[model samples]
Target chain A: MSRLNEAEIRRIAELAVKQLEGQATAANVEKVVHEAVQRMSGEGAATAARHERMKNVPPHNQAKGQRIILTAFGANSIGILAGLTSELAALKCDIVDLSQKIMQDFFTIMILVDAGNSDVAYEQIRERMARVGESFNLKVIVQHEDIFKTMHRV
Target chain B: MRIELPEILETIRMTEVEHFDIRTVTMGINLKDCISDSLPRLKNNIYEKLMRTAAEHVATAEKVEAQYGISIANKRISVTPVALVGDGYYAEDFVEIAEVLDKAADNLGVDYLGGFSALVQKGFSKGDLSLIRAIPEALTSTRHVCASVNVATTKAGINMDAVYLMGKIIKQTAEKSADNDGIGCAKLVVFANAPEDNPFIAGAFHGVSEPDVVVNVGISGPGVILRAVKEARNADFPTLADHIRRMAFKITRAGEFVGRKVAELQNIPYGIVDISLAPTPMPGDSIADILKAMGLQDVGAPGTTAALALLNDAVKRGGLMASSHVGGMSGAFIPVSEDQGMISAARAGHITLEKMEAMTSVCSVGIDMVAVPGDTSAESIAGLIADECAIGVSNSKTTAVRVIPVPGKTVGEEADYGGLLGIAPIMPLSKIDNSHFIHRGGRIPAPVKGINN
Candidate 1:
């Protein structure tokens, strides 16, 4: 679902209250507000609840494991993604996000994967990626997403 | 908290490409309870206690490293000062205990075992004198044992007698290990106002006030800090300082996490996290490089000390905000031999011994890992220690001297102390003799500024 901005939420709440006017009992107002929010959020309330539950459970036990950010840097070469993704797939890591670019003979790739459901441990997955990168003379680094959030964000 | 994609990539680059890692996880063990008048029983008790306390140290540190995907470089052990524990023992007896400590460290797969120390900041007890006398032999005979002596404090004046004694002892140690280019002296340190829970080698010792067992972690990442500074080249001073402070906070937070995890695994209390920007001999991991990246053409050039002052203060400010129990010498370490940039600067004659001493006044520890000529008088060495002690006592900061006098090596030569100790060029010393001043030694009275009461 797309993000709901503060302005949109406020506008929807105001509209709901205005529509109920004199008949706006507390329960009637609450129902109108909930329905407006659900419609504006582009998902049913039940689907939002399911998403919250998914977040509460440990990432490894979920269908998609914890998020890992893998970065590779080296000379521009073909078939790099083919090599890396095959190894990751064997380890049960699901690709959640990926970006690759080549500039002036330099190649760089960044992949965010969910390794929570992977049978391999974090260390093992890192080692496996390192081996694959080394075969193509590239440098691969894997780190947990939490480290970045803790360091970069408040 | 949701982690952004760019932040994750930045962390990966820092750890994998920039060589960011925890420097050490040192376990401090109190051996006061291991004291015994009988030499053999005392040795046995000390060994058994070390074995029991530090048995899981290496394995646990390794496990944690694998779990976190970060490297924990060294696992070491520090115990209560031997002078206090080996009371009434002869100098030779202290040597035996040093051997036992070395054996225990070997058994536990630890790289260094500190606390063969004497605290004679005021005056020498019989035990302190004995341990001082045994230092040269203790350091040369054992491979992993580290020795330190505290000779001055703000409350108590400098002990001139101990200073003189350490000078002679240092010379003896260098002579005893001449074949190794005075490597024994690399393992010894002389401190003024030394911290009790320092996790760095050559000065680490469990203070008399510390608990039975505690885990202290030393986190280091000169490369990481350098990268941050380089990225903010065009920014103003406040912005640059904020960048460094933020980086330091993250580094210290990681250190605290590792320290707490290791402490929990060992079932011991978590001790302080020493957020010293310790540098190795690696190409990109020098503290001097950080200063150079800050726009100094060379490390010892003008404004170098000012840059170091800013870096050191910013690190402490950042680290203090990151960890509740920050202690030890929590600033950037400027050991010459152990830093590649420093080695290059010294070799190019851009930096000098006096400049290093001046830098230490602002940095964490005093002149460290410096190599002087063999013919340099013992009196001069004592005078150097006295000068450094004066700085620590006056400023109420922790200062230490770990200069190695490479016997038969003169200026323009190099002494290769392999591995983490690195290599040093034999820097020239003053030709002026301070023998009369050193020989007429008496306590330099504590400064009036120390009387804040």
Candidate 2:
């Protein structure tokens, strides 16, 4: 069986939603979309393809451009992002993406960084970030992107 | 697909604020082929094989930890039960073998090497007897070698003779390491129906059925569960259980990922992920704290056992869904000394040894890391093991005892065994003597549960 591409999956999902519009409840729409995706993906073929792709990516290349997800939560303070991003810059880590917000007087920030070219080790980067966060009374944590992907994604 | 930012942040929060981390990635190296009738050759063979198999164990685990930013708390090795491998060896010969294990573990730079163990659930073989006798000296002499003896199983019944012998061994081990606060006893455990693939010490051992070498992972995160329960404080029972189940699912998935990665890197088969909420001496990382979060005033409060039963069941239900292969004592551990909340509860007289036994009936392992008075009789200790074994055998669960009789320490006094073993307030034991019962050197017949086959 051929593997389903991203576009094919999206098309199937959209079609399933449209076909179930009036007759199906929200959960039924979800079930229809899920079944459509499952049918289109040809059972285990998509997973096999993913494994094949993962094998071709060399470890050196994988390590050269590592992804890190950093989160800081605690007291809401001004210039917190400036302080954090500047520390990443000093460590030679590039911020690929970022989001920050304050809820109920608690500040929360999430930053995705490419630390491939960083001069320091990942542990050192985490330590520095934690130290900077502590100065602002925040709890900082740095974790690799794979953890989130493996945990949240199938 | 891009992962949700909230999920990513929650994972980060768990590890950063809560103590979510991979507790152990133990390499199980089978030493069956290293057996020899000559003691010296046996030791040499075992050492060479362990060095070759586990040389990269610690380094590989550390490398994976660095790559994933997950803390692998301990790197350890569990070899084939030494009693089986040292078939005809005597007590002294077993001690020599233990020294070799200690040397290999030191060379590999791992913290602990388990499986200086004997499985005598039914009856003692020559090797089992020799190993049991050698346990006290072996544990006292070796720096990182841990020992366990299985004295009961559902099918085989409880070996009262082995239980009584282990009681004496425990006393001797405590006295042998008296200067170190009976720390040797901390490295030993007696089990009923012990899991072969358990990655946690002091009870990890490679079973005969296991492959030549395997990598088993033990993932722990009591603090993370505590935080989740705290957040769901006002929720109903179903919501609370669902929250714990989801958290356990995530934790086990993380463990499975790490275990597979480490196994692949080391060129060994991935064993099982022990999804136990193993507590540490750290304050927030206490399983008892999770119980308190479930609305219990303190850990040993009246509703604590029921609360623990719910937590344990939820953890297993969630973890079983996440991992394809889940084994070991995969539930909540209520070790007294290892958990700060349990320690304080014992000191405050809110928890006692009897209550601990009751709690264990619903949890993973029983009567673990409990410290008793110096004068606690060996017979009484054996009686404690018998009771715990009865619980395990009747219910077809795994129960273990790692009680330490701290030499020269009385009730209300504390004995400190630093590092992960932690400290414990010596609890008083029953005054009633059980020497007659323990001295009745025979097996207790298997219960009705064991007759299923």
Candidate 3:
């Protein structure tokens, strides 16, 4: 019964811009925002309940910057990147940055993924990524990037 | 905003390769309010409080460990010294209280519960007398309960009466648990100037001044520092100190991060990050190895104390810079049975009991996890503890004795405690009698205030 607040509207607008990938027209922005509002309102009670649940979680414990860092270690092989990317795409996780190195027969790939817009939980994302790692016979480490920042930064 | 690839990889390498882990996340609970006139009510109150407060400790630690990819070696609990809570209880009642604590620790899934303790540095109350009497039986009856008694302080001098009593108690504990290599003695620590917020077991206790409940962390990374020391082999002392400081800073930061996160999740105040480089029995993770890497021929060489002083000082200096809240005995721990290198040194007869005693002067704690001969007399044990207490009193620092007299085990034999408690080589002890000196059991007056070099 309550209308969206300014911050919520701003969050929606920002998510829409990220989805549009710089091809934002006024009409397109309006249409995306309209769709999102309708979808959210359709799940009004559930969304409000989730928000209430989230209020108890301290901000720092949440995904820092709404992102996670995934590091994979395994033997050099084909379809590793394709398989991982497809799974991430299916989960609506955006690959913000990625780098890979192959030393002799072994390979180490580090990917920074943004899961802000994904509907899934952080634990679910980590579990799903673990499954993908298992499928590729890789040892995948999915950690909230906040830990690295806490240790390596200050 | 971006962390480089090398930095990320280095963090991973520290945990995955170097055996870097949070030594323990110890929750300290105050039991003063759980006291009651009825023994049964007191026992029930203590059990219910511990169960309710620490209900989520293990689960929270697991979640944090999984999230951060860093391992928490042990989850533990420390309570307000039971002697303070059970003031009117008898020794038998105290033993029953120890049983409740043991059961609570087991049900909570914590490895150990400390603070079955008494502070009689100056003198003992009636309750302290009861708790002291109960120690051996309490330890023998329980698996997870640990006990400590503070018998000296810089200001209070040494309570030789308490010192002599603890020696007898240690002997009784060893004899009662004789089948398990006198393991009960391993769980009892006698201290001079014990730290209130220490997170390590067999010594940790929630001090009188502490808040009702708080979470404190102990950091471990001997392997990480050993690697750094190896890499800086050619550097001079100052440069070497810097390398150690930087490494200590990183590990302490990691510890503080984990501690704060755990406390946040538990909704309790985060007490401290004890930056002690506690070593384990695992290969390459040892304070002795770090000393050897620091140019010592072996741990017991002539310069062993100097090497330990340097390592201990550098750890404290670096750790102080890394965390805002630091407390406990934040110095390099050299538990003989717990550190593999120390065990090797003992087995080789390279590190003698005398050398280890001298080293405790400059280290965080006194001679720890030492297993002497079965026939070692109680007076000799009292003499040894008094010696360490003298060092602590003179230097205004903390010291302790966790010596075990393995029944039927002597020099050239080893007490195999397995897993974390590790193996202890029965080191030789001097046979010269100190009965006359120890039997004069009055208090040693407090040392002169500062200025008497």
Q: Identify the candidate with maximal TM-score.
A: 3
TM-score of chain A of 3: 0.59
Pick by lDDT: which candidate is best?
3
Q: Per-prediction interface RMSD? A: 2.5, 2.0, 1.1
DockQ category of candidate 3: acceptable
- Which segments of candidate 3 are over 4 A away from where they belong? A2-65, B450-453
Residues B366-453, candidate 1, lDDT per residue (tens digit)? 8899999998888999999999999999999899999999999999999998888898998887869898888987788888877889
Q: Write the per-residue lDDT of candidate 2 for residues B1-453, one digit (tens) a residue.
A: 666778887777677678889999999989999988787889999999999999899999998887677889999999899999997889999999999999999999999999999999999999999999999999989999999999999999999999999999999999999998799998999999999999999999999899999999999999988887988978999999999998898999999999999999978899999988999999899998888888888977898889999999999998999999999889789999999999998999899888899998999889999999988889999999999999999999999999999999999899988888888989888979778788989999999889995
Ordering by TM-score:
3, 1, 2
Ranking by DockQ: 3, 2, 1
Looking at model 1, residue B445 earns an lDDT score of 87
- Candidate 3 clashing pairs, residues 3+ apart or interchain: none
lDDT of 1: 0.89
**In order of the candidates, what TM-score does chain B achieve?**
0.99, 0.99, 0.99
DockQ of every candidate structure: 0.23, 0.35, 0.46
Clashing pairs in 2: none
Candidate lDDT scores, in order, read: 0.89, 0.90, 0.92
Give the 10-residue window scoring lowest on summed lDDT in candidate 2 chain B.
Answer: B8-17
Off by over 4 Å in 1: A1-145
List model 3 lDDT by residue over B331-396, tens digit each.
888999999999999999999989988999888887899999999999989999999999999998
- Single out the weakest 10-residue window by summed lDDT for candidate 3 chain B: B444-453
Per-residue lDDT of model 2, residues A1-154, tens digit only: 2466777877886888688867778888888877787776675677779878976775435555388888888989888989999999999888878888899989988898888768798789988999999999998877788888877765
